[model samples]
Target: MDDNDEDNERFVRLLRQVFRFLHLVLHVLAGVFLTAILVGLQRRATDPSYRSLKRWWLHRVVKIIGGQVSVYGEPAPVGSLLASNHVSWLDIPLLGGQTELTFLSKSEVKDWPVLGWLAAKSGTLFIERGKRDGAKGASECIAKRLEQQERVLMFPEGTTSDNKNTLPFHARLFAAAVTAQAPIQPVAIHYLNMQGQTHPLVPYLTPQTLMQNLWAILAEPKILIEVHFLASIDSQSVPRKALATYTEQQIRLALRLNSA
Candidate 1:
């Protein structure tokens, strides 16, 4: 590109940021107000009722950010285990909106100020990776959730990475799927702009500067995230480790994402 192109890009980014900033404020206010109502409603909500409200809230937030989410293939069974590549925190809203699934996240997320509180309120499962017993407990909790016919999203890769690279998946979490005899639906999430450009805005958020993080999201031009739900694999088909590798490859192929 030329200087004019650079300038145009900068202008577009700036416009997006301003809009995002306004949207962010609206979302915060909406979250606070809606959360209070949800808390009250949860008291009288059946399991299915709670999932419906959660899905609606997630969809509204993703829309506010000007992100479009698309999913392929049929939704796996209600309680099927979903294993997907971790790209960014946005995965929360993207995945949350598309499916009525609970997530298994690291223990630290439980301590985050607002985000953490929201995850817990929304039925996220926090796992202590450092303790072996904790993992077992998490697996048990996941199984129970499946028994309730609620899907559970697990990022066996353990952490998020740049949009271009997917990390190796750790198979230990697969134990839960095996125990529950749940079909594992491997999913790939891709972020691209209208021109098929991979914008860093998709996976730029980190733990630092919560304000800046929110700003980065609000400042981006419209983002498009594609979620491909691949074929479901039976956990009992092979060893858990082998299943992990196969699932990883299938998702990478489905999204055309390269791995580090």
Candidate 2:
């Protein structure tokens, strides 16, 4: 590319980022009004009166972030355990917005600037990432939610991966479904660009600051995330280990991502 071309691209990205950033700030400010206050950090996430507020609030956040969610296949019935492949931090809001279900999140997310406050206000269950020691406690918490007839989604991969890879599923999480006897709904999430290929800018990877990835998403003019809900599995019948493997295969197949 010529020097002028590179300069123009930079200018465009800067302009886009500024415009979107202003909109985001205004949206956050809007949270003060009563209607918006319903989505406040103090609101009860599981309150029946505001059941859809969390989902609606999430949809707006994803929209502002330039993510357009497209769903394929039906989401499993309410109270089913939704299992999906992890991709980006955006996955939380993107997936949660479309499905009226609570999901597990990184414990640290509650401390993120604005998004942290938002996630904490939603029906989110927090877990410390990569601590096997906490797995049992996390699973037990998830089981309790499931037993309460709440739809709880979890990323069995336990961590995010680049679009080219699908990490092996951690069987420990599937135990939640077994304990609760809830059905497992396998979900596949894909971030596709305008060309329908995996979006290079959206994946969350090490060494890349979250601010950098967030800027890239905001600067882009278009975004598409496909959420495919696969067939439901009977957690009651299969052992958690088998349940984890099968659910992972379903998500990998739906995303059409080759194993690394």
Candidate 3:
């Protein structure tokens, strides 16, 4: 490459980093300001629910980040359980920005210092893997919530993938939806770049840390996040393992067709 090309590339990288850092500052400031407003709201005789507040804050943050979200399918109503393919940490905001969603995250996330605190405050349920009792308890809690007609999102794959294709789902997580007899809708999330390919910066693959992926997204000038809400499967009719397999296949097919 010529010296001019090298200089241009460096300049672009610098500009991207600067913009990302600015976005981070704005996100944090918005959180603090929202917290203060919430405190005052709590004192009043009547106020909006914390659930609504969270939804609004997340939605506003997505707007501040700037981009067009291409939603292909309709979101199932509030009472249904959302079964989606896991992509990146950004998936939380992208999904939450659309509608009120509470998800079950790994127990490790519950100990990540400030991030842990924020995750818990946002109503994330921490599930400990391999602990039968803990898993049972979580399932019960999820069932209770669904019974109350609250929406819960579960990433049955149990880990993040390349976002190009979906990993097989863990059937255990689908038990609660079955127990509650709630409908399970397979949701697909994709982060696309300017060239119509998977966003180069968004995947949380090996050797790439969470912060790195996040900063990469902030550096990019534009990105498109696609959300597809596939048909809902009736948890009442499908057995646990069948339900899990079907949901996974649905998402995989969605991404495959879109890429084609």
How does each model score on lDDT? 0.80, 0.82, 0.78
Q: Write the per-residue lDDT of candidate 2 for residues 1-260, one digit (tens) a residue.
A: 99999999999989989988888778766643433567544557788655676677667878997877789999888778999888888887787688788879779888987667666666678897768768888899999998888889898887788976689998988898998899999989889899998998888888888888888889988898898988999998688899988888888888876654
Task: Report lDDT (Cα) of residue 201, candidate 2.
Answer: 86
At residue 9, give the lDDT of candidate 2. 95
Candidate 2: lDDT of 71? 90
lDDT rank order: 2, 1, 3
Lowest lDDT sum, 10 consecutive residues, model 3, at 39-48
Looking at model 1, which ten-residue stretch has the lowest summed lDDT?
A: 41-50
Tens digits of per-residue lDDT for model 1, 1-260: 99999999988978887876787678767775776676876542336666787788778778877787777886687879999888777788788888788888999988987778777877888999789698789989998888777789998878777787788998887888888888899998888887877667667435645466657776665788888988999887567898899899999888775654
Off by over 4 Å in 3: 36-47, 63-67, 257-260
Name the better of 2 and 3 by lDDT: 2
Best by TM-score: 2
* Deviation of model 1 at 193, angstroms: 2.5
